[model samples]
Target: MISIRSVGKTYRSRHGEVVDALDDVSLDVREKEFVSIVGPSGCGKSTLLKIIAGLVPASGGEVTIRGRPVREPFPDVGFVFQNAVLLPWRTVLDNVMFSIEMLGLPGNDYRARARDLIELAGLAGFERKYPWELSGGMQQRVALCRALVHDPSVLLMDEPFGALDAMTREEMGLELLRIWEERPKTIFFVTHSIPEAILLADRVVVMTPRPGRLARVLDIALDRPRAVEMEFDPRFKAYSEEIRALIFRPRRERVH
Candidate 1:
C-alpha cells in the first residue's frame, strides 16, 4: 500500500519566479490496486509520480510506501517513462537484464525471469533485436518488460503509450491489462488521455490545472477483463461525461 499526504512541489526559475507544480495533493493506493491519474498538460500528474518514486523530492509533506517514507528510489519500485529509453546498443534481453545489473541483484538468478517477462510482454523471439529494430509499440513492450523484470512490488508509469498511434495505444492498453491480470502489482499510471485512464484503472484520479490539486477521484465499477466493446456501455459513457465535465467545466461552476 502507498499513502501520499498533503504533498506539494514548487520550482524556482533562474529569474527568481516561483512556480507551484503540485498543491496539497493526497491519495492512497491499496495493495495490487491499479490507479490512473488524468489531468491537463502541466497539471503535475507526472510530478506526483516522481515524488512517490523519489526521483525528485517534494517541497512539502510526504509520500510513503507501506508506512516507510520515500526519501530515495526504493528497490521495490519500477518506473516506465513516456519513451522506452532503452540502451540502443543493448539487445532486448540485455535491456531487461539491465535492471538486475543496476540493482546489483543476482544476474544469473534473474536471467530466466527476464526471459519469461519478455515472453509475457509478447516479445519472445524479439529479445535478440535492438530497440531501433522494433516498432514503437514493441519498444514500449520492451520497456514494460524491463520494469517488471526485477519483480518490483510497485510500478510507476508515466504516459508509457503516449507516443504510439491510436490503434497501437489501444492494443498496448489491452496488453497492459493482460499482464496486470496475470501478475498484479500496485500500479500508479499517469496519462493525459481520459479514456485510457478509464479503460485501465480501478479508480481514476482527476487533477485540476496548473498548481495541480486533486479535483475528483472516480471509482470505475466496470467489470473485470474489460473489452473495447465495454466502452459503448451506458455506464462508461456516463463516467466519461462526468470526468470531462470535471476537467472542462468553468472555474465558477467548480467552486464549492
Candidate 2:
C-alpha cells in the first residue's frame, strides 16, 4: 500500500549546518500490512513517518501510496500523534465526530457510526465527558477512535501509547488488537518498545542511528489474533531479543 524508495531527509540547523536525519531509507508496506518501526532515539523513525504522511518532504527520493507520490496528506490517511490532541472543551463523542464535521458532513449522517466507534473503542459511557475528565488510557482510546472515525485506508501511529502507565499501555495494546480485527487498515506504527512492536506488527523494520537507514526487516512468524498472553511465550521473547540486538548494534559512521 505504501512505497518509500531511497528517501532521505536533511534539516538546516540555525547554525547553518546541514544535518541528515535519514539517508537512503527504502521500505515497502503491503496492503493491510501492520508494520512497526524500531530504532535508536534519533534514528529518524518519526521523520520517515512524516514523509510518508506528506507532512514533511524528504530531501531526496520519494514516498508513494499506491503508486502516487505523497505530495500532500491523502484523505485516506489517518495520523495518531504521541498525544491525543483532542480539544479539551469538546465531549468525547464530539471529538470523535470532529473530522466528519470538518468534511462538512451532517452530524446526523455520522452519529450512528460515531456511536459504534465509541462503543468499539470501549468509550461508550464516557462520550459526554471532556478529555481531562477521562483517564489517560481512556483518552488514548478516544484518540484512536477519533483517528479511525473516518475509516481511513491507512493509519499512521507515532508512539500513540508511549506516555501511559504500563498496565494501561498493555490494556490499550489489547484494545488496539480488537479494533484492528474488527476494522483492519494498513498500519504503520512507530514505537520504541520492542515488546509492543512484536505483539502488534506483521513485520518490524529496524533502523540505524542518524543518518537513519533501514537496517533489517524481520517478519513475525507468530500466529495472529495475537493475545497479550502470547507475550509470555518463549518465541515472543526470541523475537524481542532479535529485534533488540538489531536496533542497538552500532552502525558504520556515515561519510560526508
Candidate 3:
C-alpha cells in the first residue's frame, strides 16, 4: 500500500559539509503490514519515516501511499514521534482531541472516537488528567490515542516507546499490537531496539551506517498474536543475530 522509490536525503551541515543521510533506499510496504527499521544511530531510519509522512522532503526519489505521491503533510496519515509531545495545559481528553481541532475536522464526529481510543489505551478514567500527572507510559499512550483519533489509515511511528522504561516499553509494544489487530493500519516503525523491532514487525529493515542503505529486509517467521515470551524462541534469536550481523558488519555499498 506504500512505496518508497529510490529515496535519498542529504543535509548541509552547519559547517557547510554535505552529509548523505539516506541513499537509494527503496521498499514496498503491504497494506496493514507492520515494518520496523533498525540501524545504527544517525542511519536515517527516522528521516525515512518523516519523509514518508511528508514532514520532510526527500532530496531524491519519492514516497507514495496507495497511488498518491506524498508532497505535503498527509491528511490520512498519523505520526507518533519519539516523544509524546502533548500539550501541557490540555487534559487527556483534550490532548486526544487536539488533532481533530488542528485538522479542522468536526469535533462532534471525532470526540467519541477520541474517547474510544483513550479507553482502548487503558486510560479511560484519566481523561481529565494532564500529561504531568501521568507516567511516561501513560503519556505515550495519550499520544498514541491522539494520533489515531482521526482514524488514520497509516501510522508512522518514530520510536514512540523509546523514552519509556524497559518494562513499560514491552507493555506498550504488546498494547500496540493489540490495537493493530483490532484496527489494522500500515505502520512504519523506527527503533534501535533489535528485540522490540523483531517482536513488533512482520519484516525488519536493516540499514547500513551513515548514508543509510538497505542492508537486508529480514522477514520475521515468528507466529502472530505474538507475546513477550515469544522473544525467547530460537527463530527470534536467529533473526536478531542476522540483523545484528548486517548492521555491525562493514558497510557495503548498496546500489538499488
Put down candidate 1 lDDT per residue, 1-256, tens digits, no spaces.
8999999999989999998999999899999999999988898989999999999999999999999999999999999999889999999999999989999999999999999989988888998999999999999999999999888999999999999999999999999999899889999999888888998899999998889999999999999998888899898899899889989987677763
TM-score of 2: 0.95
Candidate of highest TM-score:
1
TM-scores, one per candidate: 0.98, 0.95, 0.97
Of models 1 and 2, which has the larger lDDT? 1
In angstroms, how far off is 88's CA in candidate 1? 0.9
Cα-based RMSD of candidate 2: 2.0
Candidate lDDT (C-alpha), each: 0.93, 0.88, 0.93
Cα distance off (Å), candidate 1, residue 212: 0.5
- Clashing residue pairs found in predicted model 3: none
Tens digits of per-residue lDDT, candidate 3, 1-256, equal 9999999999988999998999999999999999999999999998898899998999999999998999998879999999999999999999999999999999999888888899999998999999999999999999999989898999999999999899999999999999999999998899889999999999999998888999889999888899999988999999989988887776544443
Task: Identify the runs in model 1 with alpha carbons over 4 angstroms from their true place.
Answer: none
Please list the residue runs of candidate 2 whose C-alpha ends up more than 4 Å from where it truly belongs after superposition. 252-256
